[model samples]
Target: MCRPTAPRRGYDYRALIMKLSYQLVEQSWPLAKEFRISRGAKTQANVLLLALSDGEHVAWGESVPYARYGETLTSVSQQIERIMPLLSSQTSGEQLNQMMPAGAARNLVDCALWDLRAKKANASVATLLGLTPASTVITAQTLSIDTKERMAAEARTIGNAQLIKIKLDEHDIIEKMEQIHLAAPQSQFIIDANEAWSFETLIQVLPALAKLNVALIEQPLPSNNDTDLATLSSPIPICADESCHVSADLAKLKGKYQAINIKLDKAGGLTEAVKLMQAATEQGFIIMTGCMVGTSLAMAPAYLLSGASSFVDLDGPLLIAKDRDNGFTFADGQMQPHSSAFWGGENNQTNVELARLFTS
Candidate 1:
């Protein structure tokens, strides 16, 4: 007979990304930020910027508006409203998750804690996380889903981008892929299906993607319907985006996906995200760290995780029409974390130029 296990010491290790009041900011894009095959009608995606201030130190984070995840400007705000009382009582990031279920609110608060901690220590977020600061991490410039002609034109315009992430659905996939590949043959390509492809379509799409030298395909099937993935033979490794959130989502994805797209919002914060990266790597899954649409403050923590990631898509800040002051630098599809933007750094001519070129 097995002996009874002793009671665990210390705090229970599950509840994290909790305790933080969120402020939902509705900002407008001068023009509609279009993507290939959008599911919503919003020209502007509502950004929920979280602020976690513990009297002296303050931190900020952002969450993109995703309707597919059952998120909206109103819904996210309502969720935050319900958890407002619970957030103010918590002290550390480790005990935040249990306060509220995993979603964007926890993501923002979790990220804010990392920022607040980094600021209070007077260290970069990377240093705080035990990772070295990186000069640059290659990012994927997105080409909005559209007709071949329109897409080719957009591809030509983003001449500085090293890699182009083309958003796709099941329709005219080869036509769109070939158009971009033909137009930007030298530019590397990655495809994100957003869980829109069926197994049959994936079989049809993967071969063409490989032929075009497409680097990777993201979340081809819906997260709940990944059972068929392991059995099928494919030309390219499929990464889990919607399927994999925090490290806890890893074990179930073992045979189903070759890689995981780690997003701070999905991981609930950078604290768990670091652990998520370690767990994914230990399990032999390649990491691709990404972000949803938000400001530079939101992208900062995700930048810290890039060193170990196989692919980096922290280009959410790049997609916005405007960003807050002292945001991180992103040029030619690469993201560089700032040393002390939150502390100092006035907007200047170069910053204006950077903003105009991308934001326009």
Candidate 2:
């Protein structure tokens, strides 16, 4: 799960950082299967990848621009391009956090900075962040909305995984879930309604959700109308997805949600994600690390956040066709983080002379 820092290898330590430059790529990778939610269905993950390089030392960060947040690949890409001139060796994560709002654009820049810095320092990002390396992560595989037979069939295929999240809506209520539960009898379930349920559906589903041993319910009501959650009681814990974002959300989500799902894309990046997780814990909210559908580049950074969370849903790579080199490995429901080669792994380096040439 870990490796020693690789030597500079024919590179001058002082020359690793020549000057800073960045670019963004809009990438679309097809999902392994149809992924449906209360919002809709999608067959591909359209993502934006930001590459910040001081020439040879390239650092990458990925973000999935969510339409729910008024962001698309184009908008986020433009945001990064707009902010590029404002960044340099002088810029800091704190400064970037302020320059951009907490969303996809800022997320890309923040993580790219982390990776670049780690590469320059010739160390792991975990060491830079004052965190220990993690052995393995247990990610929550998703069961998208489907018919009873379809869901049950899929559940059985996943086998007796430790955790599986069910995407539910106001339709079919108990029937599909009951079938799924029967199919994956050994799995723990989390219900993600995606703001589809009403006050009536909320009340109606709680008992069956409890009976099915659903561990949590995620965003059953819309963010704006979730005030009622403060008063309602349910057997299973209620988590906030759409309702929670940065640390600022901790104040409002305190009484309304028992858990908060933190996506690095949504919370900005690992810089803000760590802060949000700390703040969420301080405010008595159990944390769940989640993701949008993307490749291993997205999941690799998110794997850092999973170390401290109660529930982890960084299964984005598992839903895709393939991944970047040495991507995370998911087997027996456990996920091992990617090697340093993929992102900010130990001994990551490039030709300082080539980087110097680019800077020149």
Candidate 3:
């Protein structure tokens, strides 16, 4: 039989322990409620709420499902079911990482632990994680993919935004960029293809987008097909969204992408998200913090990384028809911190009311 090793120096093996569990919730919003490279078709987003239980404090986390990641409500529930047994037994973040594959389920559970830890210690997530708080970070407000005229109209409405993230499909690359530039000439533009374009189409599109002063183009090619990018070049920097997850992906993305968009769900949670951010920075990749469509709970952990990112795209809550009571406040194209009723704030809920809402 194998024996456990002695505890490491300066480590508390038994202190600050917690247990976590998850539930799936499906929410429906109107067409304009979701912003993406593809227009919303009566948006319905699935969220997995992660609840962490310390002896005295409880924390919650939410994960938004993305179809591109092979995740649906049923699939995420199954993933969580398989790992439920380990949530209460795992003693450390490293141990939790080994128990589940990196994805939305793990992300929610991982973030909940971070929240639980923060509450137990009465510290903010940033302070607990050794990161500084940002007063106001420039965020990219997304314009959903639509007809050039419609997209232009949407862009005009968000004219106060400093950076505009335009969603594009393989078609109408020039027309969309032209329309957006004409409408919001003063705003910096960023294009996200969401792994929808091919190398040939990307080549055909970059020159027009570059001329329009697009600051960045994200995930133009599908993740599996990204190797083809090394052979091509463009004026606007390319950022890897689907291509990057944990720190393990950094070596593979070296010359292919100038930046990487880090989402809490993709990194499996805020704990690993921070690790991946530091690793990406050391490897010389510009950082962007992004999110899938969900409420304030989903965006909370990502706020911890805003200080290190060049582009902040945690606008998911803003796209929802209605959000949690303490959801982020977005106005004049700027995102403000959540109020005390949400995570990282005073007077936060002491019980798992959100979790019970989904479970019941």
TM-score of every prediction relative to native: 0.83, 0.91, 0.87
Candidate 3 C-alpha error for residue 237, in Å = 0.5
- Which sections of candidate 1 miss by over 4 Å? 1-32, 87-90, 343-360
All candidates in order of lDDT, best leading = 2, 3, 1
RMSD to truth, every model? 10.7, 6.7, 8.5
RMSD of candidate 2 to the truth, in angstroms, is 6.7
* 1-360: candidate 3 lDDT, tens digit per residue: 112233335432223323433333344433335455542343645566655555455567788767778887567766766666556623456777888888888887777777766676677777777886477667788887889999999999987888988888888889878988999988998898888898989888777777886999999988898998888776888999999999999999998999999998898888788999999999899899999877777887798788888889988776776677756788866888876446754344554455454335
Q: Is candidate 1 or 3 superior in TM-score?
A: 3
Q: Report the C-alpha lDDT of model 1 over 1-360, residue by residue, as the tens digit.
A: 112132234322122334433333434332236534434323444566555544444455666556667777556656665655566524466777776666777776666666666656666667656785357888888876788888988888886678888888788999988888878888888798888899888987777789886888899888889899989777788899999888889889988888899887777777778889999999999888887766666677777777898788877666666666666777777776664645212211223322232224
Weakest ten-residue segment in model 3 by summed lDDT = 1-10
| lDDT for model 3 | 0.75
Error of 1 at 84 (Å): 4.1
- Provide the global lDDT of candidate 2 against the true structure: 0.81
List of clashing residue pairs for candidate 3: 107-268
lDDT for 257 in candidate 1 is 88
The runs of at least 3 residues in candidate 3 whose Cα sits more than 4 Å from the true structure, single-residue gaps closed, are 1-42, 345-360
